[model samples]
Target: MSTRWYPIYQRGGPQLRVFLPNFWLKLVRPTHEQPPNVVQFACSMEMTKYDIQNYLEKIYNIKVIDVRTRIALGETRRVPVKGYIVKDDDTKYAYVTLPRDEKFVFPNLFPENKEAKKDEEATLEQAKQSLSDFMDKNKERPNMPGWFSI
Candidate 1:
């Protein structure tokens, strides 16, 4: 049987083994003050307490003292132009407590003066502008080859 589908043990079968778990967890800043050893995470909605514990212990190699989870309601907003109401997907939050001595701080993923994405966007815009200019210049000659002009 696939590792994911292994049935839970009840009638004296060997313990179920979970391999290649597909859960994802994103570290998030806590809106309120918290203990140094406690970290907040936003995770997939389907994860249970056991799943969270296993994910942290197995994937991150972090020893978890305790875990608590709760579902946060998504905000409802009105579409700017369509004047229709929209709601974002609800998310699950996990509060994981580590050993008393271990503390975690969230790192900044995006830094200033890094124009990698901006350069890519600029290139794309330039290509689109060139195509538009070519189309405009070809208005007088429908069948002329692209290389025929300067």
Candidate 2:
């Protein structure tokens, strides 16, 4: 059974099953130092205490001793150009406790400079294509601005 919703039994009904769930959970670095046995996770807002317990127990094969969850408010920011207000989506944070002998540390997703260089190259390649297309389109009108046409 997955985390999808199931119809509730009216009365003396059989159990229901969930076939699919699209929830996402990211293992993030803890903002504050925590005990070795405690692991912090940023999960989908729809997740509940029972869902977390089941996910860890069934998917990760980890035994959870306790679980606590809280919803964190997102920060508000102003758009640089438009000067309009924008708010990020709130996130659900879960602090899961593992067995006494177990411990967890967050892994580094990008550890070296190679990944950043690759991303820069990719962006530059796309920009070069766009510039070439613009120059070709404006070859007959040398002084035309890039945004002259729709």
| Residue pairs in clash, model 1 | none
Off by over 4 Å in 2: 1-18, 108-150
Cα lDDT tens digits for candidate 2, 1-150: 354666676567776655666766788789999999999889988888888889888877889999999999999999999999999999999999999898787777777799889999999999999999988888887777877954
lDDT of 1 by residue, 32-142 (tens): 999999999999888988899988887779999999999999999999999999999999999999999998877777766558888988999999999999989887888
Worst 10-residue lDDT window for candidate 2 reads: 1-10
TM-score result, candidate 2: 0.59
Q: How accurate is candidate 2 locally (lDDT)?
A: 0.86
* Cand. 1 TM to true fold: 0.58
lDDT of 1 at 134: 90
C-alpha lDDT values of all predictions: 0.87, 0.86
